[model samples]
Target chain A: MKHQRWLPWVFLAPTALGMGLFTLIPIVASIVLAFFQWDIITPPKFVGFANFATVATDSTVQVSFLNTIVFVIVAVALQLGISLGLAVLLTEKLPNWLRSFFRSAFFFPLVLSAASVSVFMKYLFNEKFGVVNWLLSLINVPAVPWLTSPAGSAVVIILVYVWQNFGFSFLLFLGGLASIPTETYEAASLDGATGWRKLVQITLPLLSPTTLVASVMAIISALQVFDQPYVLTGGGPGDSTRSAVMVIFETAFQRLEFGQGAALGVILTIIIMLITALQFRLSKRFVFYQ
Target chain B: MTTTLEPRRTASPRTRPAARRRRIDWGMTGRITVLVITAVFVIGPVLWTLSTSLRLPSEAFSLPPSFLPLHPDFTSYAQVFQQLNMALLVLNSALVTGIVALGQMGTAALAGYAFAQLEFKGKKALFSVILATMMVPLQVTIVPVFLLIRGMGLSDTLLALILPALPTAFGTFLMRQYFLGLPPDLAEAAAIDGATPWRTFRSVYAPLAMPGLAIVGILAFNYHWNEFFRPLILTISEQNFTLPLGLVSLQGNMGTGSISVVLAGVILSMIPAFIVFIFGQRTLRTGLTSGLGK
Candidate 1:
């Protein structure tokens, strides 16, 4: 091929320009806006560290951050735990059609819109007219106020988030499980290892790399969760289910506090980056790559 | 699977009948029980939604709710259409997601080709930067993005949702991986024939990369179709709402509306994504798994 000086640049222009205008520029604007006080109609005024200080001391924002953290931990754990369990089960003996059927069944939720899922899930979890309480009554249990109470909404949020998300980690774990050579398992079997012992000594260590990737991806997405709680609870029972993104949305849009919103966004972005960086740092010791 | 079946299959001749009973072993029984229970748990809610939507609005909360709708009703579906601008919502959502998907495919394919097969400086740094943008959650930049959209005179319109989403990091990475996995000899053969770089890509590589383009396109459609946060912030008018945002309002009206009607709206929203799931399941699966490095 004859050397073409600008062909690559031509190819790169659209993505480069679009990302610059949209992603890169907005990020810079968000940082800058964090230092200014402006409603949608007001002239922008420089506020220095005031916006950050106000946002830091804001009780709702603090609770939302704390809620976001608690959310990330529980949702990620349940997501990884359930997905790993299902992935292991799928690897067991089953008809090919049956296996694929189960796989699709688990993965089906991932394809649905989260807002829609939250909508239906809200109905299902309703205290009086919902199926959940109906079933609970059938079992001689009391109706729970799933959406009204703080702890109940927290449980509902985790359940709904995990239900929609575990399939992703399941797919990752499936991929990881597929790559494990059967010979290693056979050698363990020859040494009289069976069931639980083999899973601990062989399957787990061999699957660590995939687990690392799955957990990291799961945790990152879980931290930014919004659709479930925003729709289902509307951050009800006094900011109980409000997520960090919900706060960002509320302050910037509903309340029209753009500067404080931007500050909260910056703080969240920093925390996300720190958490991600910490995971990678810890991966050095725990993640087993083969 | 072979590991599970090996012992049974290799059982000595007289033990074959015993093998048949092996299916009742505690491990096998427990495994099947868990799988069946899980299958029920995972799929049950959606079924309940469908059944509830089909019941009369008055029967939406019938005791011991039936999975089988004895007398299927259409009143709720009628209510949904009457209440919302169903056609406009679909039109708006289609316009946003369709164009966004196509735009992402174009940008991702070209940039992916450049990163995969073309020679350039700062390529490594550029690609890593693009991938790093994935970590910047949409909430973090959305306020400024709304301002940027406003600045462009596209405020309070569907374009606000479509434009900011045109540049995608994951799609680019997927397409790049697709292009890199392509056989090297296509470009080599075109080069040996004295083709220009443009000619090589246009004639040789582009046609073969359709599947890759499709993966990106489908990924975009599935994502933007269900996207909520951006549309929630950017689009304000009722006519500008996507399916998810529109459906959220349906839920918002729960104080006055029947639960069946709300569930009907929810079920209506799931149809497009469900159709995509059926036809593009394998493509979506490959797109998800292939994004992970070896």
Candidate 2:
């Protein structure tokens, strides 16, 4: 019995140890380190709330925070909408060939790395020879500055985020769509319900649980946007595209202000936690998990 | 719920014939048109990158540029090797990704097996903690992780990247949920046969959970291989740079107009992940959809 008792602990041992060193420790250290000032090489000193105050008042941080908010709002909204639409269409017993083709085409971007995607987009948006510009020229529209201007850069970044992440939401939506009973649709058809009315009454309400999870996840990922902006714009065109995470990164490594970076990270973390927790709490009202 | 009401409302026999026909036309034409437009907007940039990669240096930047590289050159890929030891970077990526995937899978599988199959004190609490960690944005930990790596003097090595990745809370949760579907008698029978826990895990539970493991591995590989920020801060040397970091450096050298080399780097970097996806697409899709708690 004693030996059997040890088995659970033994089975849990590997993950416990791994999380202790890698997950728990780092999380605790990062939180505590936020209260101190250090340059990694120097001894850290208790600086209390100064780092927090400094980050809060910093103009650059404010811009990044705003950019992050905009990116999250726009990108998540667009991605979720497209994904839900695709999910509904694909799951409606469409021709298998078309379903497969659309599925692969939509999901293709999800596999490609952000770095590569940005690199590819860089050429596509190139002012002189880019295909996008070339295509626009055919329509008699002027070439738009894509990565060079602040607003332009944010637009591209948002587009990329939407493109890459929509697949995940689509998959989840597909799953939710699969679970809906055929009898429900059959009964609705008998009653003469159809189109947007049918969709609003049936699909939207049924997909609530998936929508809640996907929306919360989308928000979290949007706030954590790093690679796309980092590679494409580096928060460039005058700090216009800088996200909160970018500021944290630049503060910590580039400036070597470890404490300040940790402080910014902690603030971002708390806000994220609060937002996500609120999402979880609110989801209870609407989400009907099967 | 809404989908149920759609076909009924539109296809109802009570509706006027002309209006019904118009609605049918709109539904079919409108949705397809929008999908096609979205596809073009979504995939245009990526396709351009592929075409650029195949173009000769002269054709790459020619004004009113070539959509398809007439005389396609694989020279840029060769240049990746000659200039950056691209093969070495690929090797480094594979080694690190492989190790991290395996390490994470092992931890996740064991923990997940326990969570699903074994009962113990604090199990609910511990599993909830694992689930809670999933909500913690990874960005919060990067600074501390970097500091940890630097302190350990592992910053310039692959160890830095591989070590931090092994403890994946999400993977554990995924595995646990998957394993929950298996009958308990399988493990109990294995126990009766006198197999050790590790042996039973390797020979019995693992094979049963292969699909879940594949999903875990594929996601892990895509995540680690595509990762840019960690490698950027951790690795200092050119030789140690993974594919993404190497590409960033490659872009720096070629600058803006050298579409040939830049596109080449992008194309080359995408190959491994694309290949994995092609073979693993079904598994990934099924895994992702089904991977969340049933």
Interface DockQ of each model:
0.74, 0.59
lDDT by residue for model 1 (A101-201), tens: 98999999988899999989998998988889998998899999999999999999999999899888999999999999999888988999977898888
After TM-score superposition, the amount by which residue A50's alpha carbon in candidate 2 deviates from its true location, in angstroms, is 0.9
lDDT of each: 0.87, 0.82
How would you encode candidate 2's per-residue C-alpha lDDT over A1-290 as one tens digit per residue?
Answer: 11376688787888888777777788898889889999967899998899999856899988888888888889999999999998787776466887787778888888888877877776677777777778888899998888888778888888888888898888888888878888888899999987567789888888898898788878888888998898888889989999999999999989998888988888898888888889889988877766
**Per-residue lDDT for B229-292 in model 2, tens only?**
8888888988898888888778777787466776787787888888987999988776566545
Across residues B62-109, which tens digit of lDDT does each residue of candidate 1 receive? 787787998899899998888887778889989999999999998898
Task: List ranges where model 1 is wrong by over 4 Å.
Answer: B1-24, B183-185, B191-196, B254-256
For model 1, what is the error of residue B202's alpha carbon versus the real structure, in angstroms, after optimal superposition? 2.8
Clashes of each: 0, 18
TM-score of model number 2? 0.93
